[model samples]
Target chain A: SQQGEEDPQALSIQEGENATMNCSYKTSINNLQWYRQNSGRGLVHLILIRSNEREKHSGRLRVTLDTSKKSSSLLITASRAADTASYFCATPYVISYGKLTFGQGTILTVHP
Target chain B: EPEVTQTPSHQVTQMGQEVILRCVPISNHLYFYWYRQILGQKVEFLVSFYNNEISEKSEIFDDQFSVERPDGSNFTLKIRSTKLEDSAMYFCASRGRLRDSYEQYFGPGTRLTVT
Candidate 1:
């Protein structure tokens, strides 16, 4: 079973609008990371937030982690057409699933 | 700029045949993993290898699945007899030793189509 589940399986917005996606997990984690895939070819790591940290940012991406809620959200500000892709939240496992368990992902489409 | 590399960008095989997916992880990385995603689905973890052995795996990983580090830098996932359901994109990932933070780097996936 996947450890994380993200709400809003799909999203569409204008290029300049902000896109927000949420991820909820069921277990303790070493860290939570977000990745973007363009057409399912490869996954590009975006940002990783440790359990202790509430928030993190890289470029226009902002990620928040609420351990108490076992959930996280990724916000892409001032989005571009290039940001259109599938976004996934991965929970780095600590026990049986030691690699990274991924969520179903949100298919985000950024329009011009 | 180090990255994980996967070979045979795509492969087609018949059912009941064995398939091996190859990967070359970052030179200094100590942990390696294999994952797959069926069409229009999320990537799922298959297995993770560390210390030259299987460290972890998902329920999706059954008797048909096995992982090995054939050499110092090469990691491989072997499917004893692939079923049609096995058709998916397989990805390889690696991260440096635990002391270096264990942030995984992923590779371009190899698309396998079982005919």
Candidate 2:
């Protein structure tokens, strides 16, 4: 399976603090994406880092991809209470018609 | 910004009954997909549709599952017979036709409870 596995299943932090989540996958991938999901809500795309690209950033979210290690990380700088959500790492297979394989996700809780 | 929309935010039905979940993907998008996530489980892919036909489907999408674009705007997933294990949050997603556009926008999801 090409499913990504995320570490630190859950994390809790205070507002203004930085939070980092890591993901490791088994096989090669075309790109890795990060998505945020609030409880019982739809997934919101955050960022996508191609295999050739080592890092990418969007606003407060920073994503890093290391193809050599088959791992990726997401960092949210200065998180706020509203930032609390489950962060998932997903990879799309070149042959899967853009269908995404998602990880277990990291549950983030930012306290005010 | 266009987004996918699904009907019946929550549905409860008896096992063995047929259920059809409906979705209207982003207007300009050409590819559509279905995914499900059981409570506390990873989201799993079910099927992908393009050009009004199934492009690809996962093993989970068996004979019991079928997808159709009944009209120009609506996409539907029908389960022949629902089992207790079929209960889950089903999400509909879509992406633009651009070759490089791989981002899939998802709907809020329909929570199906099979009793």
In model 2, which runs have C-alpha deviations exceeding 4 angstroms? Answer: none
* Best DockQ among the predictions, by candidate number: 2
Q: Model 1 residue B39 lDDT?
A: 97
- Please write out the lDDT profile of model 2 over residues B1-115, one tens digit for every residue: 7879998899999999999999999999999999999999999999999998999999999999999999889999999999999999999999998978999999999999999
Candidate with top TM-score is 2
Query: lDDT value for candidate 1?
Result: 0.88
For each candidate, the alpha-carbon lDDT, in order, equals 0.88, 0.93
DockQ comparisons of all candidates to the true complex: 0.68, 0.90
TM-score, cand. 1 vs. native: 0.94
Q: What is the interface RMSD of each candidate, in Å?
A: 1.8, 0.6
- Alpha carbon lDDT at B84, candidate 2: 97
Positional deviation of residue B74's Cα in model 2 after best superposition, in angstroms: 0.5
Estimate, for each residue in A65-95, the C-alpha lDDT of model 1 and write its tens digit.
9999999999999999999999999987665
